[model samples]
Target: MSPTCELADLVLPSTHWTERDYLADEVCSEWVFGQQKAVEPLYERKSDVWFWRTFGHRLSPEWWPWESDEELFDWQLEQTHAGVTWDELKEKWIHHVPMMPSRDFEENGFGTPTGRAELYSVIELVSGSKPFPEATEPKESVYATPDVAKAYPLTGVTGRRYPIYYHSAFRGIPHLREIVPEPQVVFHTSLAEELGIERDEWVWIESPTGRITMRARPSDGIDPRVCVIPHGWWQACPALGLPGYPDGSSNANTLTSDRAYNDEFLTPGLRSTLCRIVKKKEGE
Candidate 1:
């Protein structure tokens, strides 16, 4: 579902959470509760339970316990607080269970070596994870060797766009797009003058892995050496129209690389990749 979907022969629309009999083991603040459905579904969509149970019965007839979702739901509710039942949830829509602070291990203190908070964790030491939060240089940095900087001069950083859009999602949402119309690449005012890049000019940000285009906005708040791009763009918007999406609206991932990463986890270096900014020519 990223870069391209050359292998997908057909696609199906999915039911939104609001459209079905919703359920979740939600943990918020100090209590846990089971969520219930809100409204009836409108489209040609079916509940996820139907799909899961159908697949389960097909995959393992011996171990699959239930003939219906109601049977499975009843089985799950039986594990809740002894006094509560699914009937209560159907009527009240939620049942809250207080976490057992009543446990008598001296007011349920943290089960640590000191019987209190331990700044240095013995648990991580045993698990072989990093015991302390340590700062390390990015895999790619502006302070890197002179030759490396010359080749890819600017640092690329990706950040959240807005509350409405989660990554590349909801750009097609008209009201959300009205709040923040388009993606923009911000730069320091001095850097903009140095590069002869005018305000609102479209610029291509090229990393070692790939390149994407974004509009330029000169601001003193941003660092000249770093190019901050918003996250989650795809080539499927109707604004592009063409099956061949040559423009950078889908250029979101092109500004990042996986060459360097966190030592403990192989997470991509989204904020550490090096890139060069270029003003786009006419019609590009």
Candidate 2:
């Protein structure tokens, strides 16, 4: 054990090592193996709590006693006899959780130095960015300026699917691929026709910043101005040598912007952008 520990210590570089070496070693274990064990438990626990809180009333009568015909004690005995453990039975049947009423106020009641919800936030004042009570404009209007809007006409939205094998990652799988086989650029039928792009054909989507190639999928469900591309596509497999797809293809991140995002929260707006699409040439 001591020898193995000594060997591991030797392999793990000191804090003074450069970022690239640190990242290379970190990725081998942290991304490849450690990620699942680290993340799955937090996700599972949150999901379980959400399930219990959201639907606990439906499964047991005691959860809604004012509406229930039976008493709480009767419900407990009934649940316990059915082979549920005491803790599980109590969580399902005996807890009396209160529900809060939803309210919307012009001012949410917290005051700053001005003693009111500042129409302009303190940060805006401090940073001299833009004043608060900012005008509400249609999302596409940001690009409506004559010069900027012409180059990037369509609203490009991304990242709206499950994490594992979303977008184009699982496109090579038989059963899953049958459902959705490739990175899809979703646009309205009229827009697709205007661009002379056909459904399921490979098209190059471009922003002023960057571009990536994906299959077009025209749809009426999305707003006419909005175009969607789901996220999470791994670089293509080199060993398999698949046609029309090369190594390092299909990551939506390639076409996304790196601008400072919206002010409500520090979260990056991966879902919103401006782009245009064109069909790929025959070869190369």
Candidate 3:
């Protein structure tokens, strides 16, 4: 559906934000403002408003009677009953929502069934779930099988973030790669020594689900029982890496199992899986 995926029949290139105008609210519910364009649209880039308006006209012309973004903004302002007007905001570049004083809890009462916070939730009980919140073991973690643990003893904690690269993004930049050049799996030095692995050496982190090769970094910060491998590395992408690290980087999820998941949420196990790290073998 996206550019790399190449699943779409039509791919209309749009303009970046620098070439277009935008109106948005602040992080808080306090202010709404507009940002002006700095330059003309480059290449085939188009403003976001243009697409929304175009799509709206196609879906239903009556619902989108406005001819331009300005007209739409005016109509939205007309619908608001506040004392302020769009003209004032156009000059000010911001519209602030007036703050209200805190309400009296006892006199006003809460918008709850008992007019107060309930220690016990009746909704959860009615749904036939746990009445109280309690920590439970990860169903797919440690306690699965005694035999399995004998082979894959260590615990894995994946998805650690790096400051230089974001989740699969910013990797293509040369400057960022120069900062943190390789994807590494951190382990306690003691564990590495016991496993016959050395620092900076290639190692294979293996689980019943899958295995991946990455560089080993010795660190006291890492728990001996737990191994840390970062997420979002792609050997297939244009991301640069060290000489030993190839064009195809091992993504943590490739070695993660999706077979078992929470019945209620239907989520895969990205963390808390049984695994072991060892020196990379000849074939691997």
Compared with the true structure, all predictions reach lDDT values of: 0.67, 0.54, 0.72
- Model 2: runs farther than 4 Å from truth? 1-145, 162-174, 221-224, 235-248, 263-268
The runs of at least 3 residues in candidate 1 whose Cα sits more than 4 Å from the true structure, single-residue gaps closed, are 1-10, 28-39, 74-83, 101-133, 144-146, 235-249
Output the number of the TM-score-best candidate.
1
lDDT of 1 at 163: 87
Which regions of candidate 3 fall more than 4 Å away from where they truly are? Answer: 1-20, 24-26, 31-37, 47-53, 61-96, 99-119, 144-147, 235-249
Ten consecutive residues with minimal summed lDDT in candidate 3?
240-249
TM-scores, in order shown? 0.74, 0.50, 0.73
Give each prediction's root-mean-square deviation over alpha carbons. 4.6, 15.7, 4.7
Clashing pairs in 3: 14-45, 15-45, 15-46, 235-247, 235-248, 235-249
Q: Per-residue lDDT tens digits of candidate 2, residues 1-284?
A: 12234457444222221111111113322121111112323222333222343456677736643232123323443433443333343345332223334343444645465656677777667765575666543334344444555877777778668444644445455555445555677889988888787889888888766788788899989888777876665433333443334433555666665552555454554666777777688893
